[model samples]
Target chain A: GDSVTQTEGLVTVTEGLPVKLNCTYQTTYLTIAFFWYVQYLNEAPQVLLKSSTDNKRTEHQGFHATLHKSSSSFHLQKSSAQLSDSALYYCALMAGNTGKLIFGLGTTLQVQP
Target chain B: ETAVFQTPNYHVTQVGNEVSFNCKQTLGHDTMYWYKQDSKKLLKIMFSYNNKQLIVNETVPRRFSPQSSDKAHLNLRIKSVEPEDSAVYLCASSFYEQYFGPGTRLTVL
Candidate 1:
């Protein structure tokens, strides 16, 4: 069984501050791909970033995440958080082309101005 | 900017009733998935159809069934819905990445 564990339920940050949403996973599969998805209110969760290459940092929309297989982590980070960045963040795992995602409970990011 | 469309944004039905939620994707994707978001906001995979074939059936209950008529459409039918079935059902398409619909909210009384 594959599983993903996120930092916590709620993460509040002041606007323009650095943010990091921790994510770590456990899987029996050898090759693993990880994803970070953001879901706004009443909206579908959209892929924010993804990576499979271990130790390589993947960046998108001013966010970056590195898949560290040795550490079993793919923590999402942003240098400067915006108010609009308030949303639910999910970390998911996939092995090969199965397309079946094992997701974490999700972390609600609330950036206050 | 929705590539996926789910019919009946909201539905309220009594227990033991039957309900269907339709999903269509115009993204020209080969895979479509049904996900259940519980009241606690924990999203779980229910079913997945790839190229109109059933591929992944996560430990979903037998009461819930998924049918795909074509590559673009996947519908969920719940026979004799129960109170525990109340949740937001989401339809998604996978083209390397997943594109999701707004989701259908199902409430069982």
Candidate 2:
């Protein structure tokens, strides 16, 4: 019954503008870790950031995300969006030690120049 | 830097046909997973193998099965493919964070 939700299916932003992709999850397990994965067109999805500690920010490749247990969210954010940042982003949750990932319906980011 | 590998970048088969996909990871990870990415790019876990043992089996159809010969190799087979099975199959291996393969795109016509 665990699930992840990405509210936006597509987010368009101008280059050099701030952007945020919302991610929220509901899980029955106690131990959990959240991940933000980015996939370019015709490429494999790669980890952008991962965090298990609640309220701690995890960042990679100019993108950052903070896991908030109180809100049950781990939203990915970037201060200045670039043309190269246009890609499909996925939010995933790993519950317990099972190694199974519950992924959200991905959000496609289109940064216009 | 791509440690996970999957065979057959693309596949096209008729409905009811059988198909198999091969996946290998050079990361030496004990946990390997198979995920289905639908046309909407929604990802769902299908199966997971840990050290050659079946750990997670999602509520998928019986035609779908996972084969693991070793910790590094995990294969997926569909006995009778359906039209709805047309999607991208992603192979991943993980210790803490998952590393995904290029994925095998399946088109069942």
Candidate 3:
């Protein structure tokens, strides 16, 4: 079965500090793409970054993630965390062209000022 | 910015009742999906429709069903809802990247 794992349930960081949210996946499908979605309080989840090429970094809104095929990891990172960055982050994997997404248990990021 | 739309931002229903949530996408996408977000924010795919055809049906309860009128519209219906069905239902449409609708929060009491 295809599955995604986000190790941290919650990650707190001071504003302007570096932050990283770990994500790993296990899938039998050969063609797949990884995505990071951010959901603010009372809002819909939106794509933060997406990548299918292994070892290539995909970035959006000051956040970046690189997909490592060998390790089956696509970790999200940001150099300077902002208070607005506090939200629930989800890691998802889409295998082939099925359009089905396997999402990980989200990680809540709380950036304190 | 919201290409995907869902009706009834929130709903409260009693157990064993039936409820339906409507979803529509203006992105002209051929693929639509339904995902359940639990209290712990654990998202799981419930069903997917591609070009008005069922594509992916996860191991969800038999009480749940998906209805597709066209490529842009996908509706979810829960028959005899259970208390455990209380969660956020997110509707999404995608070509390569999925765009989600403002989820409908279901509270089954």
Rank candidates by lDDT, best first: 2, 3, 1
Q: Candidate 1 — which residues are off by over 4 angstroms?
A: none
- The true-versus-predicted C-alpha distance at residue B68 of model 1, in Å, is 0.8
* Candidate 2 structure quality by residue, lDDT tens digits, A1-113: 89999999999999999999999999989999999999999999998999999999888989999999999999999999999999999999999987788899999999999
Question: How much TM-score does chain B earn in each model?
Answer: 0.99, 0.99, 0.99
lDDT of 3 by residue, A11-47 (tens): 9999999999999999999999999999999999999
Supply DockQ values for each candidate. Answer: 0.88, 0.89, 0.88
Q: Taking the tens digit of each residue's C-alpha lDDT, what string does model 1 give over B57-107? A: 989889999999999999999999999999999999997778889999999
Question: How much DockQ does model 2 earn?
Answer: 0.89
User: Share of real interface contacts recovered by each model?
Assistant: 0.89, 0.89, 0.89
lDDT of 1 by residue, A24-95 (tens): 999999977899999999888999999989899999999999999989999999999999999999999987
Stretches off by above 4 angstroms in model 2 are none
RMSD of each: 1.0, 1.0, 1.0
Could you tally the backbone clashes for each prediction?
Answer: 0, 0, 0
Runs with alpha carbons beyond 4 Å of true place in candidate 3: none
lDDT of 3 at A87: 98
